[model samples]
Target: MRSALALGPGAEFDRIRSILGRLGERAAGVGGDCALIPAGDGQLAVSVDLSVEGTHFRTEWLSLEEIGWRAAAGALSDLAAAGAEAVGILASIGVPRGAPASAVTTLMDGVGAAAASVGGVVLGGDLAAAPTWLVDVTVIGRVEVPVTRGGARPGDGVWVSGRLGAARAALDALVRGATPDPEAREAFAKPRPRLGLGRALSRLGVTAMIDLSDGLGGDAGHLAAASACAIEIDLGLVPIGPGVVEEAARRSDPPAVYAAAGGEDYELLFTLPEAASLERVRAVATATGVPVTRIGRVGEGGGVHLRLDGREQEIHGFDHFA
Candidate 1:
């Protein structure tokens, strides 16, 4: 298996950011300080993500459209973490020599569609040869309503934009040699994040939010630890994707486990004042055509706990280091 760094979205970009000071333009750097550009008195929020063939997804399981959609959506997802309105993208693709031309076209189409879905587009890209297919995207976005992890308060209600564990379920089924049901397969192949909802949450008075690409358990931990608040999720209320229940039964894995530890769900984990009206948030989601649900709340201390039908489950999520 490839290590995280070799796979996708694993490189520690900060070290490289500081190192780039030694080099000049061209490496003029992920917009190098263009993100520093003024934004009509709003804060600039930038994020980038990469995806690789074997590590991120295997070609055997995903269709051409699925890979393309995931490539762009993954990067946009990071932007969502910051509650930013994405404007556009810069893409770089590393394709192995002798790869078919049709494959490239298909993947690029996916990128275009995904970006368009988010009200963003790819300005351009750099293509090169590598041993595997690699897609990297640098997303430029703006935050009119900053929703970082630092703002969670004790009484904040915890919520997610959509279902959990779908993508993970899709990928795990492939890994275990079990055929995924149509819904499970779709979750992994073409995961969709709640786009307008992230920014809408900001307008609706959200304090902190993150998309559930990394799994609810660890992602919640991120919001809690960063906000210095405690987080406890009610497993019973977790919104699950279609076909997850029957799929888990077929695979002999705990359905709840899939909901908690599963990666690539692309749902949002956000905090709002407990007293704030969810009517507007729901209305906006309905207007913008996405589904969202409040699942938990932040507390006084910084820690993570999971209570399921009154039984506690161990915390779970992606652990790149482990």
Candidate 2:
């Protein structure tokens, strides 16, 4: 068995650490963040994420620009999850042999545009040939008040920024014969990270944080597990977007499922001290013009549970690499 220090939230780290222990007691090769390199501390916040053609999006439904936007935003959302302000990005694009030259150019344009959307820039990237299209992005950012998933306190209040599940609906609609509305299309095509809100919340003294790129249930569970506390979320309080509820009703799928299982909703979910100021959350919403919602509170030190009609229910968020 491996110690908690080496468990990067899964069995892979545990398995590797166990093998290393058997080899001989020695220092682990990797450090904080994502690679053999330490995630770094004090100033810079580093994060990387990947979006593949088949799993993340379909070229037929989304334009090159839209695809670029989704791929870049997915990585930026990780930085947001850590409450970091992004400065620049590096993108590596994998082109299919059948991809058109115009499509490739548009994809590049979208990467540039996505970075610009967050007041960031593209530093550099690599081009490669692949059987299918793929885009990998690494974002570099700095946060004055870094918020990590492991910082939650037992009494912290749990919150989420903006609406959930719209992206899932957009894709489902596209998969079916139904046409997506402008808002749904935008949600699927170009997801905007709440970067401003993340910075503000860090200054506001949030105990811990993560982006809701995964379903809210799963993501919040991550926060709870990391903090060694129980997470209690109120389903009724989940901020559902306009048109989403009606459309979900039309589809006969529980709106809660999308809100809980949707993978592309790039919103921020965080925990704050029970006594933290509401004013800061309000200020963030005002400055960014994005809604910040209080869906639940951290429970007695334990795991995560979704509270519906005041009853606890079992659920979790999305984990692509789990």
Query: Best by TM-score, which number?
Result: 2
Residue-level error in angstroms, candidate 1, position 195: 2.1
TM-score of each: 0.85, 0.86
Residue 72 accuracy (lDDT) in model 2: 89
lDDT agreement with native, every candidate: 0.72, 0.75
lDDT of 2 by residue, 167-251 (tens): 8778778888678877877887888977888888887888888787667766675666667777778888888754477667876
lDDT of residue 126 for candidate 2: 93
User: Which residue runs of candidate 1 sit more than 4 Å off their true CA positions?
Assistant: 1-37, 250-254
Candidate 1: what lDDT?
0.72
List, residue by residue over 1-322, the lDDT tens digit for candidate 1.
0011111112233244344544545342132112334479886666677888877877788776678788788878877767678788877888789988887888888888888988887888888889988888777777765666657899888887767777776676778888876787877777775657777777788887777766888777667766778887887788888667766676676677568878788778888898987688779779867777777888887777778877878856764434
